[model samples]
Target: MLANLLLEIGGSMSTLGAGIGAGLAVIGAGVGISGVGGRAMEAMARQPEIFGKLQTAMIIAAALVEGAALFAIVVCLLIAGNA
Candidate 1:
């Protein structure tokens, strides 16, 4: 009985951790993308001639951040499923 109870608790904890990790990953990605956009806009404002380059760089950076977040979320879900 005790073992079963412990096992249940462990599973719950793992699920909770996975959820938290996924949430954090999403939040981090949002922050990263925002920062990239903000910086790119600032740079464009300061140097209008480089707007094209800045926009391209910003999009690339945002995409990378999103990809990482997606990967993290998938890993978290897998962990939760296993748990």
Candidate 2:
């Protein structure tokens, strides 16, 4: 099913794996950032005085997740191109 579709579209196992890896990376990043945001909001609600600190931490965590996702996507693209 899904494997057959990926095979037809990617033409090689390496490409298919790369595609799946890239997608998973992006999805993981999204989940990570959302969790950071949601938790930050909850913390801010509980301790309004520390809102600024929570915001800064949230931004940093989100940036790290985004950077890792971008790196994963680039590696996947390289693998796909080479294949």
Candidate 3:
């Protein structure tokens, strides 16, 4: 009984930890993008003439952050499945 309990705990820990990591990773990306978007909007409002350049830069930055987040999620999924 003790051995079984330990095994269950160990197995659960891996998947649970991976899930937490994956969630946090995505959350961080979302927060980063939100901030970027907010700043871009503010800048656009302040300088209507520069709106196009500012928007382009903001989108590229957001995409890079989001891509990293997606990669982390994929890694977490693999880890959970293996666990």
Best by lDDT: 1
Per-residue accuracy of model 1 over 1-83 as CA lDDT, tens digit each? 99999999999999999999999999999999999988888898899999877788889999999999999999999999999
Between prediction 1 and prediction 3, the one with superior lDDT is 1
TM-score of each: 0.97, 0.83, 0.89
In the range 1-83, model 2's lDDT, one tens digit per residue, is 99889766766888889999999999999999999999998898899999887889889999999999999999999998887
lDDT of each: 0.95, 0.92, 0.93
What's the C-alpha lDDT at position 18 in model 2?
Answer: 92
Cα displacement (angstroms), candidate 2, residue 33, comes to 0.4
Q: Write one digit per residue (lDDT tens) for candidate 3, span 10-53.
A: 98999999999899999999999999999998998889999878
Q: Which of 1 and 2 is the better model by lDDT?
A: 1
RMSD of 1: 0.6
Backbone clashes in model 3, listed as residue pairs: none
lDDT of 2 at 35: 93
lDDT of model number 2: 0.92
Better of 2 and 3 by lDDT: 3
